[model samples]
Target: MTQAAADPRYGAAPPPRRRWRLSWNDPRTRNLAVQAAAIAVVAAAVWYLAGNAGRNLAARHIATGFAFLHRVAGIPIAEQPIPYDPATSTFARALLEGVLNTLKVSLAGIVLATILGTFVGIARLAPNWLLSRLAAVYVEVLRDIPLLLQLLFWYTLLQTLPAPRQAVHLGPAFLSNRGLRLPGLVWQPAHSWAALAALAGVVLSVLWARRARARQDATGVRPPVWPVAVALIIGLPVAVWAVLGAPLGFDVPVRKGFGFAGGVTVSPEYAALLAGLVIYTAAYVAEIVRSGIEAVPRGQWEAAGALGLRRGAILRMIVLPQALRVIIPPMTSEYLNLTKNSSLAVAIGYQDIVSIASTTLNQTGQAIEGIAIIMAVYLVISLTISLFMNWYNARVALVER
Candidate 1:
């Protein structure tokens, strides 16, 4: 009674304190709920689209299944690296062959473009004015033109050569409208062993270089790693070849009535496609390289020179190491672009993945499956390249504090 008289506002019982529950009222929980709702909407949309596609296919009297892949591909391919018989192989095998060819071209193009681009990039930075200007012009001219035009130009140039019957002979090689026939290396079992040894030598050399760099970092003394690495990589392979009795033979091309006999003939279509891809892609790669090199601060070069390092040493040790961090990521994209651009082979009848897939689509009337296979192959290639480049980029990335 005395407390109530002192505080009339304080009733018989205080109001219960409000309790907060750890639930969707939290920001993170609310965000999660929103994301879940969005995903459900997307799934519903996909289901609706898929249902529409099913109805459309049914109305067109088209069978929607992968069973057609087993059917025989009646059309014959002109030049397959593997042993493929049109009458014996299924459509799946034909598609596989096409995919392999595409891979071959893309891989070769990447290697060639990298070498050419790096050289051109370095040349553009040369102290010699003429050389630098020349490289600049090359990059500019090639990059400006469409790749398709370049491909056609090369194909036409090749076609303008003499007929196969009167081929322009260059020692053991012959050039004609049909193709350029050069000496082919006849591989023996021992050659395969030598190749394996070369690969092992490269792996060993990389490991050795890494160890040497680690040792140098610990002691602050740089050893002559380049010569040692090169010797290990090249000399080991040569030694392996010598040990295998040097089993090497070349098949020279000889003019035979209507065509060249022997030797490995590179079809004009393949040559044109390769030339176009390399030149066009090299221009872009050159730009990337140039930008990367330029991104390296002038202070780095000045510091290296102040340390009494030679120009070559500064470039090899200081400049390039840092420049590569900038170069690799964009360079990888260019490599992928070149790979996909190789589909332009259809214009020149090179029978690359797209060309072959298109042919299959026409013949089998399985547009969906044919297109899916092509997409899958390209997706795999792009993913593989991205994974490798990302791993390499991570290795070279600057360690931050």
Candidate 2:
């Protein structure tokens, strides 16, 4: 063998030293270079677009700043939960009121939709053919329809109801085209204290339940949790209320000459929006719930049954906890969707954030400012929900060693 070939590290002319290239020849360097180029292009495009917008606004004699935020909105919002006067409040304040109304509708819709969806989802799995088919029909029909059309249908249906003078009475409640009147709770200072105490008690009960569950898992003995939960959630509140002189009263709805009187009336627009949102969103939520429940392995059911657990116990103890891990992420998305879809309130003359912002834009010719406000409000809501959901997901995720 030749002297050069005898040394293992020495090859035949070292295979011609290839120069390291910074281009696509090297995968890592090429990817980094491509990403850098893409970022620069995007940055340049954004700057150009922003500059064009500024120039266009200036040429059109419109201010490009946020000074319009402080100007008076000069519009009255009927049926605001918080006290709002157009003459006294700034455009910002009116926008805040609209945001709150949007939140109220979305929050209520999420709660109602979850309850209805869960029931319908469980029903779809029924052993009885009629019950399962009924649930399937509901899911298919509702999910197939456009949400906007649903909203319109609900609004039209509400408008066709009898006028205030001939309102339908349901015990202490009244229903009419004008609104649905229900009894309102009159609260005193003591009621506030009772509410605070009740909230604290509920929080404490949840902590106790968590601890009890951990102890039970370690010792193979489950504690009686329901009675403690009930006491903390219900009895504590009642106890505090009694101690605080029971400062609570109901203002029941009563029939009056032209309208119902002495109760809180929810306008038809609000009712229609809420009802449509809940029903439409519930369809999607039902599907998510059904899929989640179905994803739980059949072995779990069999194992629980073999352990002599009742069907309800098997569902509550073994099935739901596992199913929730799959359910929560998609459920969070549905909630966020419902919140954004609430913007459709504009179609029915409901004073939601989008509707109010549109009116403000038309009145002040401050389209940019109005759009910015709407976008920021929605972004905040989306971010807040995403953060909470991510935190919850992390907590519930399966652990591995």
The best candidate by TM-score is 2
List lDDT for all candidates, in order. Answer: 0.88, 0.89
Predicted structure 1: lDDT: 0.88
Model 1 CA deviation exceeding 4 Å by range: 1-24, 207-232, 235-245
lDDT of model 1 at position 243:
87
The digit string of per-residue lDDT tens for model 2 on 130-196 reads 9999999999999999999999999999999998888888888888898889999986887787788
How well is each residue in 1-401 modelled by candidate 1, as lDDT tens digits? 67776786865477886565558887766788899999999999999988997898899997777776798887788668887899988878888878888998999999999989988998899899999999999999999999999999999999999998878878888888999899999988888888887889889888988988998999988777889878877888788889889888999888777787788988999889889999999888888888988999999999999999999999899999999999999988998899999999999988888888889888877788778888999999999999999999999998886
Estimate TM-scores for all models: 0.86, 0.87
- The C-alpha local distance difference test score for the whole of candidate 2 amounts to 0.89
